[model samples]
Target chain A: MPELRVDGVTKRFDKVLAVDNASFTASPGRILGLLGPNGAGKTTTIRMIAYITVPDTGQVLFGDKQVGPWSQKQMGYLPEERGLYRKMKVGEQLTYFGELKGLSHSEAVKRVKHWLDRFDASDWYGRKTNELSKGMQQKVQFVTAVLHDPELLILDEPFVGLDPINAEVLQDVIMELKEAGRTILFASHRMEQVEQLCDDICLISQGKIVVNGELREIKKSFGRNTILLDFEGPDGFLDDLESRQLVRINVRSKSHAEIRLLNDTRPRVVLDEALRHTHEISRFELVEPSMREIFVTAVTAQQGAEAIEV
Target chain B: MTNNIFIVAKYEFLKRVKTKWFVITTLLGPMALIAFIAIIGYVSISSLTSDDKTVAVLDATGILFDGLNDEDGQITFVVSNMPEDSVRKAVIRGVFDGYLLLDDQIISGSGEATYFSKDGGGASFFSRKLRNLVRSTVEERRLLEQHVPPEVFEILNARVDVNMVKLSDTGETTGGTEAFAVVGFIMGFLIYIAMFVYGTVVMQGVMQEKINRVVEIIVSSVRPFDLLMGKVLGIGAMGLLQMTFWAILIMAGVLLSGTVVAAFLDPATLNLPASASQDELLAAADFTIPSIEPAVFIWFVAFFLLGYLLYASLFSAIGSSVEQQQDAQSLMLPVMLPIILSIVFLQPLIEAPNSTLAIVLSMIPFTSPISMVVRFAITDIPFWEVSLSFLILVGSFIGSIWVASRIYRVGILMYGKKASFADLIRWARLS
Candidate 1:
């Protein structure tokens, strides 16, 4: 099992600090979701880990060894802007990439066939990559990234341009790879996918990591203070709850609402008050915050604090 | 790293060489040029050898007729007591190819002669021949009237040619300097064009890879420098291969054509005119082909390689620094300037190869790859200068590769924005 540790790595592109004091540890067999908005230093950090871009400060280590060309060989990276030789035949392109990754010629040929078959892309073997659909090309790119059986897989926005069915196929493959004990760092904007796939999460904003921890632990630390509620009653209860400051309505609809309980108010107290106003409370339950909410809250909070100082 | 370079180079070479266009161009390019030259030669020769014509002469001075015998049976003079205007009308009516008007003051050097013909430009060869015949006959008659002996007049009228031979300090004469200059100009120009053509191929290859976004995937395993070298060397090797193919093909074509032409023409046509000893004929035949020196050829290859390496690296660097094909033009201009300058200045170099301007330009690495070859062919450049030029060219080549590698390391990964010269310099320095 290999562990990828990024320690206080800083990278500056001209005057912009693309990655500032970014640090995280992805343990073996765990999927680490690198969560960030656009230009949040996600790609830069990944590039550093892949040894494509060197950090200005600090280091990235694989297990006990520092990441260099030797360690780079053990990693597979799918860049955000994925590309392949459009004029090249699918099988030849894969074989060429395999050879570049230091695989023997015969092994590269064999693995190309195996991966194509596994992806149900054997029919694409003789076709040029440009002849395939974008989703098919994505599948081919994925196979190219992992053809070497690398120990560490870094995928940046891998789900982009993928249709739902192909996305599901990729998700299953990533899960299968994770189960086989590969250390995977996945960056994506799809919070639902990250929530389902990742065991650990690192949320970066403005080139800095604001949230980094085990996914369950991070969620637990946020506390289960929000409730999922369903009711058939007057909608005036939402404003009434807001007026009392007993709960804040995070999401609302005609018959259902998700509310965050105030620090001093108890969920039961809010529920009792809601029952008095509504016709019936069919369902009410405390729930963990979604990754989207956590991400938005963390980034907004950081921005607000920074706003005050500026 | 070397292994990666070799692998990349092998791929580049194969990708280009296996293309149908490459094969067709390599095999047919020279053949087309040869065919074009042959057609032009055939047209010129046929026009020159067109049927001999009878010319009506209105020689007011009757003394001109007996002396103006036809030279080489190309023209037959028909004396007619007709007005110049009537002779011109006769010419237009196709009674004769042309007519000549000569007045009574012919021998006293106040004579005016005019040739009348339907086609102005087409009569140039015949006009020259007719003019020579009249001038020589008049001069011979003048010398005889001055009591000069006929033998002395004939001697005075004989044509003389200067034999130019290169002499060493020991008074040893080297024949065929004329052939050497011609061959040199041809070889030097070929190299100039080859460097421009194939060096662009290298640049375009880099640009293609950049445009395709394949550089990122490739630079991951192989170093950027390795990839760059592989591409440059691979493309350069392809250039060499194509050049060798053209050379052999052209050589075979020349040999085969020569034999076919010989077999077609009568042996008597090729035999020397019955006039002189065998030595003069052999000497005239010697002008047919210049003996190629083995040393000069070896130096040609060396210089070609050096020049290709120097320019190709610069071209690759420019390719990497640009964002699009349109951007390449502005960047390519500077690299192309020197090559164009070399060609523009090549005439002066060939005319006076030992001139100071020629020597200095040939010594500069940028221009030397071409100018030096021109100088080497016509004249004997000092051994030291040739070696020094070679050394400087190699040094610049290495320097270019170094600079190119730096730019390549940074540029291949950069996208979106077009990079300026300042940015390229910064990248070369920082990376």
Candidate 2:
């Protein structure tokens, strides 16, 4: 199993700092989600790791060795910008890519057929890439990226433009790869998928990393301050607690409300206060914050800190 | 690395060779050349060997045809003492291809005579010959009437012969400057056209890959320089292949034409004109075409390949930088300017192959591909000059590849924005 590490990497395009001191690690048999907003330098970091571009400072290492051209052969990169020879047949195009990745001619042909069949796209082998739908093209792109079975896979926004069914299929394939002990690093803004798929995460904002660690540990670090309440009868009790400085209601409806307890606030006191006003408290429990809440808060907090510095 | 280059080259060659346009171009060259030569040969042969045409000469004066002999092989005069209206009718009815209505007024200067024929534009070849015969007979009769000897007219009409010979530095002489000019112009023009055609093929090949967005994947697999060189060499080989086909076809066409002409011109069996000696006739009918020297042809191919490489690298760079076909037009002008300038100056080079301007242009990399060929064709160039030109061209070709690979490395991944010359220069500097 391979453990990949990117340490203190910084890249600049002209005067703009595209990636600043970015660092993350993906261990063997695990998936790492690289999260960011648009132009957050996630692609740049991935590119540097793939050896498509050289970082101005720092290094990317696979196992104990520095990443180089040989490392590129051992890795698969599906860049954000997708490209294929539209005039070439799917089988031919995939075979060419496989050969470029150092597969022998016969081996590439065999792999192309096997993968096409796996995806139930055997009939599309003879068709040109442009003749297929976008989703179909994306499937072929995925096949091209993973046909060589690289040890370290870096995919940028891989699940974009996919329907629920295809997205699930890709999610299943990615998990299968992880189970096979491949170290995968994927970048996307879709939190639900990332929360479901990733064992670890490195979140970046405005060309800087805001949070980096295991998914569960990062949520635990934020503390269990969220309270979900299912109540019947009077909803006015929720409005009464809104004036309390220690609690903030993030969402509220007729029978349900999700509340955030401020720093050092106890769950018992909040429960007692909620039951005293509501006719009945059907359910009340303190829970960890959702990934979406963490992401938005972390990014916003980082932005606010930088704004104050200016 | 070299193996990858070869693989890419083989792919490019095989793909283009299989295209229908290549097949059509290869076949069309020989077909069109043969058709052109056949048309010229047919027209000249038909005009020379046409049957005699008979003309009704309505000599109203009755004396115009008195001593005119009908021995001229091309025309026979038919005397008809008829009305002019009927003579015109006879011409229209096809009884005569034409009629000469010579009248008594024609002996005087006050009236005009008319020739009637279906062709109103001008006299036919046969009719012209008849007119010349009448004019000569009338002139002889007038000379005799003036007590002038008819033999004096013969002396006045004798043709003058001017023989031209070219003397080389070794005192070796050749007869025709005209043949040398034709060959030089043709060879120079051929390489000029070839440079543009094959150069643009490379440009468009690069542009196609760039437009399809496949170059980044290819470049990652192999160095951009390797890809550029592979494409250049591949298309260059194709150009050479097509030229080889043309050379073979043209040689066959020329040899067949020569054989046909030789059969018709068997001096021992054919009748000779009364005044022409065998040697003189053969010299006048010289059909031995001048050929390119084997060494010169070898150099031509070398220069052609080098020239294509030099221009194609820049073309590839330009192709990679542009986002679309229309975005390329303004950038193409600078790349094309030198080739166009060379063609514009080709006339002076051909006229004076050893001139200082020609010599200078022939040694410069940009214009050498064309000017040097013109120099090689019209005159024997010094060995040192040819070698120097070769060195310069080869040097520039390598330098272009280095610069082009730099731009190509950066430009292929860039999308949406149209790259200007400044951007290319910036990329070149960065790389």
Candidate 3:
């Protein structure tokens, strides 16, 4: 059974279709990355999934069962609000929240201590949340989301406000949860992180999914004929190369250029053209389109259709 | 559902109590109240002992010196040396609480005496004393005009021991000063304090939860109704606990001040004329001890809880509807107006404890908790109105809970939107 299935969901905030006809499913041991720009219905979708909100016109199912019938204890949701009791002790707050989510008091306490120590924050257990920095608070929030050992974890901006080290630490834990067969879904706009961590990706834009698929399959279908040529010269190579039948170059820097080739293009022709163009072609390598490129390409291309006269 | 309600309530109560602000404020509120009462008591006793009064004697008649001498207390009498302009300046500079101007020039025509004091004769004991002195002086002059000498006049005083006898239309006896009115005021003030404190606490708790976004997290766990009712009842318990502490404190105060209590019951402390006998004193007792029966207190608890729940629901609803403190202020006046109106209009009830208006108002559930408690305290408040008003009060409480719960549900999620009176009406109708 699918770990979670949000089918035919439609949520409108008044006249604004915040989540319009959106649907997706993720199986257990899989991470479904919900990606979108700011105000792109990512959080709203997560909110609906977390049971923080109800969808106006559809059903959210947990495994084979409808989520509406499930107890709050079944799912762990980290809202974008990113809060704990500001004046409460971190350890105490975690245990309280954990217990409220249906863990026994001792179990909650034990889980809190275990997670706190895992993050090397055992010394800060007694300290108030407000005493911690933003990154520390984010760590606390992450622990709160998982402390009850929920089968499903829905995190909205889970790695927000964390340092690079801590973000990676959280990413590792997320991967570990996947391996332990927990259905994990997190929202992020950083496409690289989603690409690295997500098994299935659902990219939402303007309250609609622009892309939804297995991450590896999506990357494979994106094609590998694209080349990033970083070299020294007058840089007219891009303009000259733009006239080619299957070449598309998007935004260039002073020393580097990215090129996407059409399905009909040959890699040998591109290599021949590259060698002929500039002798100072220090790094000319064929590369699969990065998720960042794919995101910018998809979102920009999507936005182009809705452009006004202005 | 019952389990959920109690679970929600227990957590809400524990959570609020554990809050730093609540803990600090709880400690601070009683400390401040006690310190304030003590400071007021100390200041009052000190002022009475200090005798911080400056008297200006014009000596226009130059006849009275005993006026300035209160044998036990310290009073400083300043004989006017400068013109009246200087006295005006001194008064404006707050150099004196007031100054007495004895212009005895008008003494010839029926011994008219003009005593000038700033803000004259407004409840101060000094003004009372000043009036007494002027009257005595005028009486002496009249006695002199007659054949009676000063020594004979002083010896043959006509001090009458006036006794009060209230007669109904059918000639029934009654106590003077309306002992029930005092009971009414005491109960009214207690209810006022309880309602105000608990309402404020409910408001602040809701505001804190909304501002902290803890409501969002908790709503995920529990229903909005559960949260709202839990909060209302939880704070209600806290308020009752505080009132209990106050009751204990008052009993302690009454115990420690045994001498003062003795003065209250002692017939010797009446301070009437020396010639009155104990039998006459007994016949002329001006005040009666208020009998407190268990029934009055039972009604008090019933009405207090019902009335508190009624208004507390509205308070919580108001608090949940608004985002900011300033926004909450606009919502307050409408909710507070009824209780305030009850306090204001039923004030006469405190004066005429068993008047028709007091009885009627006490029967009205809105005003019953306070007005009824007073009537129930001294008089025999009718059993019918007690049961009827209590029934209505409970009905109103249930009705308000329904309305307040509806308001809380929609209002909790409403942000950057000002809910007007009209909107509330619509919300109520819709819900």
Candidate 4:
């Protein structure tokens, strides 16, 4: 059975429908990326699955049971807005959060120490929470969410406040949990991180999912294999070139005019045209349409393509 | 449920005890209490020395200076030989606490005298004492004119030795016992108020977390009931620890202060030179104050535990719905106001334990914990009322947990908004 599932979930905040007909599933050993810009339905959907709020009309299932029937102790959720008792000690705060997750004193202590060691924060065991740096506090929060070794983890903006090194550490921990066959669902606005970490992706925009599918399929259907060619001549020498499939013209200068192909119209043509124009070809290579471009195009131009029809 | 409660209580105690805020406050409270007592002790002690009080005497009558005092703790005889114009001037220059003036005419039907001092100093005890001295001196001359012997006059002085006797057809003495009982009542009341205040704060803390979306991460693996029990027990324990430590410190401070006070009182040994005989001192060794009364100890432990749990449950529920500190303030007043009102009216309840207000507030679940403590302080309460209150408080304590959990179950997930008291009422009414 899938460890977690949400089906046709619709949630409204007053007159505004925050999550409209949202649906997803995560079996064990999988990572699902809940991707969206601010004001998107990702948080609303995640909150429903976490049982913090119920959907107006729909079902959330954990294992084969409806989320309503499942015990509250069976899940772990780290909300987007971070909070910890500023005056509480680090160990004490974790224990309180850990014990809230159903770990006993001994169990919570062991787990806290283990996570503290993993984050290289054992030195801060006796320190108060507010005394710690932002990155350290984030690690404590992450530890709290998984303290019980939850079967399914719902993390809203998990990478928030994390430095690059710590972000990678979090990714490694998520993967390790995934290797141990736990389901992970995390929300992120960072497109590359989602592309790298998540097996399945749900991209939302304006309280609606613009795209939802396997990560590989979504990348495949973006339909733009473009290359940036940075070569130079007189400025308008490349601008006046006859490449009918020019997707975008990024930078055109006296020494350089970077050009991109619209589709799989071949970087060779862009290079060939550039070669005929100038000997100052500094760099030219094929580049896939980035996830950021896909996201921007998907969110901004919903009326045109509407999430590639799936 | 029992297991869940233990788990929560254990975690709550552990979490609170380990907090630097808790540790510092726990230690800081006793220290503050000690320091406060010490400062008051020092001020009172320092005030008692070979202190001099200067008195300005504008003796216009020429012979009134014979009855006035010399330089002692008594007023110094500052015979202002200067003209009457500089008398008020001398006072204005801060020469004395106040000045006494004699009327130009003596032994008239009405002898009018003027007193001069700063605004706050006018009604002072020293000024009053001086005025009394002048009146008595004038009265003594009148008594001498009536040919009354001074020694015989002493026999007719205002004095009494009426024995306190209680009679209900038969007479029996119950001297000063009511005064001692009043002391017990005050002690009982102080403990209850202190516990209720701090314990309610604990409940508020729990509720704020639920309302603020801080508890969602906490409650996933932890049961709601455990969280509730944990906070109550943890805070209740902290209160007890604080009281116990402060009590010990106060005991030590009292003994230390008592010795110092005794030595300080030795020099200023109270006396009246005009009296036939000095009033006898009640032997200090004959009296005893309890080191720790078992009833007070039991009330402190039992009532504090029960009272705090009862009040805190409602606080926790109120906290669950309100998201911000400002909103909590308005809601908090309604809940706390009843407890405070009960405490304020405690003296009346002590005067008559079965008074209508006492009976009404003691029965009211919201006001009962504090009201019952006030009622319990004065006299032995009937088992039924005590049990009824305990029963009602325990039941409401449980019911409020249910109410809070309903709000907690729903409220913990809510963000960017507040839940109203009416919203909580609706939730409580929901199945």
Candidate 5:
């Protein structure tokens, strides 16, 4: 497997700058989660990487070779708006996609059978795509992406429209592919999935990269100021802490609350305050900010910066 | 990359060829056409023989009465001894379809005859038959009174027939003007129909890929231009296959009919004109099928391909630019106009294949495919003109493909917005 690199790529659509000097790298045997809010140029950046569209400036490379027809064969892209020929049989459609990626006819057929069996969809081989349920069609589409056994797999919003069971099944396969030494670039709005599956993260806001690094290092840089409180009592301490400017309440319920320390307030002070108000403290722990919180904070901060610059 | 183009083409071709619609159309289309022509022939022949009309001739010139009566014809002529008033009364009473009154002054060749019927319209149908009988009878009577020889009278009454033979640089061919017109019209019309049908097929195929949203996945693996070329070539191959099949069937039908007619008819008994040469008589006796020069077919195929490529690429571009079928209509009008105008010019071009309008139409790339083929069929076109027309068609197709592919690259990935003509131009201008 070869490493995939996108260096200083820029793209513009008419008057809009879709992506601005975007740069990122996905290493072999790891997952890189491309994170951004809606209309943050994630799809555009992914398209440039996938070679579906050329960037206005800069280049994308696989190992040492520039991304082009040759590199396209090595990269498997499952686009955000993915579909299969509705009137075509599952096996035939998969075989065609495989052939387009440079597989021999016999090899394509063999791999199509292997992938279909792996997905537990061997029974759908002879059925038209429209005859299958949406979930079933999705399984077939996933097979098209991996049938060629590409070195770099870019999946944009892969888990959308999937039930938990199917999503878990797909997640496991993605993990297996990573274990097999393939580089994966995953993009999604579902932050938890990225948090669980990605080794590296690149966050973009308004066509610009706001944060890019290893997920662990980025999370550590945000500081471990968030406290998860589990207790069985009135939650009046959360309001008191917030009003006192000691903490920012993120979430609150009758028996559980997530609180983030403000102004470098000590976790010990917050714990003592919680112990005084609650009858019983079952669990209280300091934790790093989640990917969702980091995403919102980074995006909002970037927007604020832009606002001030304007 | 070229390999990927073939792969895409194979998929598109096989997908359509495997459908039931393709099989049904390929097999049944020509059969339906044959059946339609047969029905038209049978209706016309039956109409001519089915009606029986009788007309009473009250001839004041008594010599005309004997020659006018003929019972074997569809319109039966009978000699009536009744007075003019009685004959008119009998015609009105439905005893005759009409009554013709000829006076003795007709012998001097200056007299006019009147025909009377309840409805005056039927006179035109049988007037020529009655007038010819009366004039010949009066001429024979005058000839006998002048003591002219009977053989000389026969020579004077002989009818002359003209046989049309087309002389060309290749030599003279015996097929008449009607054959030339028929072949030209058929070739031109077939090209016209094929451009529309196969071009629409290309458009629909592109629309299917876009609507299915499978184009993004396919384009990620191959160039958009390759996909466009693959689709057009694949569908065009199917069109060629079906057309070749139809041509074979038509040729076989012509040969079989010729054989059937030759087996049943004898040359000596046939009432051919005396002026017909031995070759014309033999050809008529054999009921020979008109031999179309192979060059006509070669040109037909050349023009069909060039014309199809030009139009299909434009159609595919239209397909990619719009998300919905209705949105394609405004874009379709400009492309469709030239094709429709070509058909509108077909009649006049056929009538005068060497006219300046025909020459201009054949030279223009948009109309050349149809116009040039028709002109080639009917007349001897200059070699330079044909070469120039072919070159222009090829050049236009290349230009169209370049523009269409550029628009298609940007349009296929675009969604949710209805693209207008201005947007298409902007896309074409994009890198």
Candidate 6:
């Protein structure tokens, strides 16, 4: 599979700059997580890469060729707004979508049947799309994206509105596709899923990319400054630490907390203080910043910089 | 790229063609129209013959009743010796439908006769029949008094029949003017209806895709222009198919009815005057089927295709611009106005196909689809004018598709706000 590259693309809608000088690339046999807050230009950038809309400036290329109708033939796209022809049967609708992507009739049909059987939804082949549940429709939608077996697959918010079981099923298929050397670019608000599945990540805020690198390296840059605390105690030591400006509590519950050290404070110092408050320390570990924390910190910092500039 | 267009077209075409509604409308629509016409004809004919009327005549001038027949099938005329007062009384007593009173002054041809009935209307069929009988009898008596021959008088009073034949530019006589008008009106009306029905179908189809957001995925796979063309061509083909089916059924119906009429009616039994020649006799007795020129049908199809393409593109543009059906009404008014105006012009254009109003309307592309076909059917339009109208229609279609596709490319992905004409114009100008 060829690599997908978006080189310095910009898009403007009327007075709004929907996407600004966005650049990124996803290699074959890897998943690129496009992370952003609401209205952060993720969908716009994805749309340009999917060849659904043209960029106002720059270009998107597949291998050495510019993204166009020809490039679109080898691209699979599942848009943010999911839909199927409500009156059309699932099998026929998928077949139509497959053929639209340049598959022969028999090949499209064979793949549609294969995907339907793989998802345990073969019984829904003859049923109208509207007759199926939302999750069922979602399975069929996923099949459409992969039925033509394009080299690159772009899924925007694919797991949205899916039950955990269905989401897991979809995640496993995505893994299998990645294993088969196909490129996958997906955008989602579920930070944990991105943290688990993405090999590389791009974070956009206010129509600008604030961070783009391998997920592990990006997390490593934040350093192992966060401490995970798991203990059965009153948890009063956390408040004491926060009030004294020794640590910032990223997460807290009755018996668990993720604390970020402030002002270059040592994890040993915080752990010694916690031991004094309670003798029962079930778990304590120093770990790098999570993708969720990295996303929030990066987007907030970008917005703060923009605020100051404005 | 063209392959994707065909794929989309095939999908759209099959999607609708397989619907139950398509089957019902294609098969039953013409049958319903035929049934409706049959009912109207039967009602009018039955109403005319159902009423039997009798009138009593009190001929104050005795010679008025000399040669007058008593019964003429529909109305019975009784030559009564009763006085005028008794005749009026009998009419009121329901003995007659009316009473016709004649006097001596009728012989001098300045007399006035009065027919009294329960309705007391001069326009009644019975009264008109009685008046004609009395006047003819009086005139004959006066002519006899002058020693004029009865044969000459009969010839003088005979009704003349005029056969209207349209002379084309080539000096060849074609069908009758009435037949041309009927065919023209039917053709114009059908095209007018098709423009609205199929144009709205295209609009609704686009709106459905936009609302469903299926367009987003489809556009990713194909150019927006290709998708738009595919849909327009697909639905247009379906409309053409339905029309062709209707045309065949109508032709079969005409042939069947002609056979039935021929089997039922014998030429020898038809009432004819002794002086009638064999040719005139046969012409009257035979039901001459008016032959519509093939060019009329060909032009009908050409105009329909051009007109549908022009309007369908505009409709699809409007469809993509709005999020809901009600939001489309404001935009629809402008597109609908030209089609409505075309229909309004149909009557006048058919009435005077050679008039300047007809000529000008038929030349304009917006109104030409219906108007030009009607004018061609009613008269022998100059070949240059026909070709010019067709060229203009094709040109406008191309222009509209270009503009509409631009708007559609931007509009289909846009949501949240109801788009206005200004927005559409801006979108059209967008790269």
- Candidate 6 residues B1-431, lDDT tens each? 78988998899899999999899999898978878888988987765442677877778788676667735467677889977788888889998888777876877878767777888845655556666777677778889888998799879989896667778765655335776787787788778867888999999999999999999999989999999999999999899899899888877876676566655555566676666555555466544555778888888999989999999999999999998999999999989898899788877887788899998889888889989999998889877999999999999999999999999999999999989899999999999
Q: How well is candidate 6 docked (DockQ)?
A: 0.71
Residue B335 displacement (Å), model 6: 1.5
Candidate 5 lDDT, A14-50, residue by residue in tens: 8899899988888999999998887889988888877
Candidate 1 residues B1-431, lDDT tens each? Answer: 68778878877887788788799988787977778778989999876664688888888878877888875787888998877778788888999888877778877878777777777525567776787788887787777678887788667768796777865443534467776777787778778867899899988888888888777777666778888999999998898998888777756764565345444444344475666344444444443345556767888899999899999999999999876889989888989998998998888998899999999899889999999998888778778999999999999999999999899888888888988888889999974
- Expressed as tens digits, the lDDT of each residue in B305-340 for candidate 2 is 788888888888988888777888899898888889
Over 4 Å off, model 6: A231-254, A261-281, A305-310, B39-157, B170-175, B263-269, B272-282
| Whole-model lDDT per candidate | 0.83, 0.79, 0.73, 0.68, 0.86, 0.86
In terms of TM-score, how similar is model 4 to the real structure? 0.76
Error of 5 at A233 (Å): 6.9
Score candidate 3 by DockQ. Answer: 0.37
TM-score of chain B of each: 0.83, 0.72, 0.74, 0.77, 0.83, 0.82
Q: Which candidate, 1 or 2, would have the higher TM-score against the true structure?
A: 1
How well does candidate 1 score on lDDT at residue A46?
A: 87
lDDT, residue A152, model 5: 92
Candidate 4 clashing pairs, residues 3+ apart or interchain = A100-B222, A101-B221, A102-B221
**DockQ of each model against the real complex?**
0.47, 0.33, 0.37, 0.34, 0.70, 0.71
TM-score versus the correct structure, for each prediction: 0.85, 0.77, 0.80, 0.76, 0.85, 0.85
Expressed as tens digits, the lDDT of each residue in B1-431 for candidate 3 is 44446655666677667767666765576677678878988988754443456666555656554444544443456667577778867876778655666565634543344445566646556556666655676566556667686679757675666554444333534464364455556567678776777788888888778877777766666667878887888888877866777667655654555444444444555665656654445445544444445687788778778878888888888888888999889889977876787788655665676788877787777777777777666555568878988888888888888998888876776678887877676666642
Candidate 2 Cα outliers beyond 4 Å, as residue runs: A225-286, A305-310, B29-190, B260-284
Q: Write the per-residue lDDT of candidate 2 for residues A174-193, one digit (tens) a residue.
A: 99999999999988777888
| Position B60, candidate 3: lDDT | 60
Ranking of all predicted structures according to DockQ, beginning with the best and ending with the worst = 6, 5, 1, 3, 4, 2
Tens-digit lDDT string for candidate 5 (B197-268): 899889988988898899989888999999999999889888888888988987887668755665555555
Candidate 4 lDDT tens digits, A106-213:
888999999999999898888988898988888888888887788888888889899999999988999998898888887877776877888888888766778887
Clashing pairs in 6: none
Native contacts kept, each candidate = 0.39, 0.28, 0.37, 0.46, 0.89, 0.89
Interface RMSD of each: 1.5, 2.2, 2.2, 3.0, 0.7, 0.7
